[model samples]
Target: MRRVLKITLVSVAGAALALNTAACGGKKSSSGDSGGGDGKKSIKVGLAFDIGGRGDQSFNDSAAAGLDKVKKDLNVTTEEISAKPDEPDADKESRLRLLAGKGYKAIIGVGFAYTNAVVKVAKDFPDTKFLVVDADQCTVSGSNVEGACFSEEQGSYLVGAAAALKSKTGTIGFIGGVNTPLIQKFEAGYVAGAKAAKPGIKVLPAKYLTQPPNFDGFKNPALGNEAAKGQLDAGADVIYHAAGGAGIGVIKTVGGAGKWAIGVDSDQYNQPAVSSVKDHILTSMVKRVDTSVFDFVKAVADGSFQAGVKKYDLSNDGVSYATTGGFVDDVKAKLDQYKADIVSGKIKVPTKPGA
Candidate 1:
């Protein structure tokens, strides 16, 4: 519930008024314009999603949940656009610019991949607020772009501890979508947590599905499966992935191996798409993207939208480890103690791998 200020203004006549507005040139509200027929304020928010958008049952879907919640609770109009594989940076700028040009009050770029696009597009439209979910690249010293960054390493550490405590083989594996600092945070935190739980725990060599300038790693389930199988064959009994949609393949592979798999971004165990193999998912590193998105919308609506970095961490409910299958119940006490240490500054999880 970080910065979540919900203002309830029921749009009883919203449909007809929206129709009339469209009929009358569709001029978007600028600087808090309250031009509705019933004297209520109206605002438009837009979201640009990364690969595996909307129904991947992971990252994109979490952001979609936020958008849906804001539309329902605040009665604001919304728009969403998904990304194409290997789309150029210019294409990202174009998509973001389209939303800005259409008069969206707040436009959010859903992944770190949109850092460049958000940086370039926000400068031209000073009046509109922009948010980048994963990367803080756009929120430089004087930029008017806000960043909704998460302490992923902190959450990853918790799940890593679970994997360590649950490992019967004394070895676990982590699969990342890309070989970038962001994904590396997952590896770093997971490894740190595992070591913290078991001083001699052996983490198999971490693997990435792809490298930079090629983000299909986040979407390609086949590659995830390939990477995971390699780790599992190496005697790793518990596997964790920060590979976005690709993590689905990691989970499936773990299921087939009759081992444990940790999910990311959402409570993946409850996801309908993964129901068939849900039992294999031991836990998920809940990223709270929905909470962040909803908070951003509320900020815009309240006219308190600031351009800077806002971090969601263990202390703020921004990140945590989920226990959907009760597989981690035996280790819950240990994990809780570790979480308490993190929150109380007694433990500082590394953000960069090998740090």
Candidate 2:
């Protein structure tokens, strides 16, 4: 049985991290030192982001929300660095090294792409505690590294059911940022849930914007738009996208066509970039990267930092289906029941497509 944890979303003013635009390399950003004169040292945290950092209004933004909470409640000083599209692993290693060398005691690599880099850098700075989101920490040899992993498939399942229930054309579509094993989890749960909700529903073949070693799929809005158009043209009236920043294009295209679009990572219904198409968003598979990030930082600050994989799933409220725009209001009861069933282990969501 999975351990259940309750998480509350905290909203605080001035929670946004201030980026130093003048920083030349790596687009590095830092928050002002919040150490007070009361003889207590403020905890310094380093956050390394994946592609489409911060304002992508999706994955990175979800991580940013956690950092923002840390700043507001923990009074922690922080630094942020983002990855470039298709950048080499060396760059990621350098970014980790730079943060560790700067004496940032708690460093977080915002995506699984930093798995190798985090492991490599953890060996060099054993005193610094490191957490990588989406990667299993148990596989690491370093004693100071931990991982924040989420059961994204669980949340995706709920939204998939929603898409199937609301889809008028009885044909739904899925778009992945990259054809990685991680993204495949979303595809798996979605297809399974859609079929479970409405047997014999027509699901379009999953489309991937890019493949490995080329992560441009996560950041390319044009590619997302193009993929969405293809699905829509093929008679898919409901589309779910786990395409990170590129998901904006999916929302735009799908909504423009007056079809339903399901968002991933963050709630797209409230995102300003997709405000014009907010009504078209049926729901979002809300993966609480923010909660995991905040929990990791809080653990480090409170000296409770443990080096191991910490998994978040539906049972813990770490991932959920968003009901923004009230578009799914009519089906909320059914969605909640499915969520309960998943939590009780009555239904097991698949981590791989067609499994």
Candidate 3:
């Protein structure tokens, strides 16, 4: 059965928090032909960041990384509108339209949360190329738009297994920004991973909001700590936080607890989480969002843009398991085989619950 992608379409500002900053590059656009310019097509690429803004160490950062690469490699100038967790859909949609009107050749929305906003913008601005990460194909598959989906579970499974192997307790937890298909993919893979390590491993889940559209759900570290503590109290020894900035709490809560947490999207092992937890960070499930974003920009610049769903996974080098934390060294041999199995179709990863 095909599952519909239920997404949160809007965000509003809530508590404000500070995080480190990183940016991607692009060139300014002119009234000349849309090929940027004659030489390199001096096109302006616009990116609207997800609620966590710059340093959620997850999707936003990943997208920025890709944009940074494209900006340098393709040499295009870029601009971005950083969304507050509470930024309204109307406000964001206007920004998208303005960016398009400003002669931006491509405008990228970094998360599925932008689905409601981007869909309308893409339709109105058919002349401009639009790309949205993790969007529902039923809603946003236009001739001018592209959806970049990922095999999150396939990669998350490996990291989940690594966390299980590194844990003393047979319990792990998952923290998500919202209980949507994308985050559900993370939760399901985590459960599968814990099971693969040792069947019957307990998995805990934490959701920040009681309702949907709370994109700030990813920006709350205090709630994350509370959730992590709840899991720890229940005897969870490791946690894989897919909760964006909320992950900071997981790191802070795990301090000296003799347990660990896996960071998602980026290598959180080298971040403040690791600085606080030492070697407690097991690994991160990386979605090279930045690579894909920049790839799209470069594609348009080269006049080779592909519309519709473009899947990114371990096979495409779009998504992969990163063990930069050294916590997975003991299981490298096993992981190598797992990677092979996924690549060769020997192992089938699930996209939904009970799948």
Candidate 4:
């Protein structure tokens, strides 16, 4: 079996780590140290974005939502390093080093592309707290670095069920950015969910790119569009995509064809761009990157940035279902039941593919 280590992107441009200290708003600190407030120390958060940046409408944008929340609630601002997977790792390391040198207390690297970067930087900057999302547990345990991962399978399962129920036709489709474990994280859960909801549901699954890990796949909509069209031509009525930017293309194609689509990460129905497809959206697998990022920032602030692998399961509201489309009411009821089952331990959806 090939172990696919799917690396995600850093984040989008709109994400910042600036703290919103209301009382300290522009008030000069008596201590003469800028950023340090009258009551709290100024905390800087660095966000290293993935290749797709903020517009991917899936993974990267979801992560940005969390960082935005932290900035609004915690009074901590952030800086971003937008790097594609194809970019040299050494260059990214230098960028991380620069942010650390500038006195950022907490640094967040959003995807697997920064897996080695975070590991290396964590070793060098023992003082800076680090957080990595969509990550595999690396060696060199540190109280400073925290891994924020999601039970994508849980959310994927709900949408999978939704896709199964809503597909006017019996066939469904799945398009992903990479062919790695992380992508599999979404794939495994979706297939299982579809099967659980509608036994013997026909599923069409395809990876956008065939390379070892095409992080760019997440940034490409054209490729996703073409792939989705192929599925639709094959009789799939509902398509679910975890392909980040590529997923956007999926939504567009589905909307253009007057078919249905399943969104991921954030609620695609709510996005202005996807407004045209709002009606066609079956449901979305809410991967709560926003909550996870906000909580991680708070952890660093409260001195609770614990090291090691910390998984976000369904029970903790880490992953959930969102369907604002026409079928939301029906989908919501079903999702609620599924949620109950998952919380009550009656359901245990596998996170890996072919499980």
Q: What tens-digit string does per-residue lDDT give for candidate 2 at 1-355?
A: 2211111122345345434342334333345445566555577788888887778999999998888878777767677777776777777887788878878999998888888889888998988999899984225547898888889899999999999999989999999999999999999999988999999899999999999888988999999999999999999999999999999999999999999999999988989999999999999999999998999888888889898788889989989999878999998998899999999999999998989
Best-to-worst ranking by lDDT: 2, 1, 4, 3
lDDT, candidate 1, equals: 0.82
TM-score of 2: 0.92
lDDT of 1 by residue, 62-119 (tens): 8877876776667477766677777788778977887899888889889988887898
lDDT (Cα, tens digit) per residue for candidate 3, span 121-208: 8888888999988775324667888888888888887887777777777777777766677787877777786678777677765444
lDDT of 1 at 8: 17
Q: Would you list the C-alpha lDDT of every candidate in the order shown?
A: 0.82, 0.85, 0.72, 0.74
User: What's model 3's lDDT at 171?
Assistant: 75
Superior by TM-score: candidate 1 or candidate 2: 2
**Per-candidate clashes, comma-separated:** 0, 0, 16, 22
Per-residue lDDT, model 2, residue 161, is: 93
Q: After superposition, how far is residue 232 of candidate 1 from its true place, in Å?
A: 1.1
In the predicted model 2, the residue pairs found to clash are none
Show the lowest summed lDDT stretch of 10 residues, model 4. 23-32
Best of the two (3, 4) by TM-score: 4
lDDT of 4 by residue, 319-347 (tens): 88885656767666887788788788798
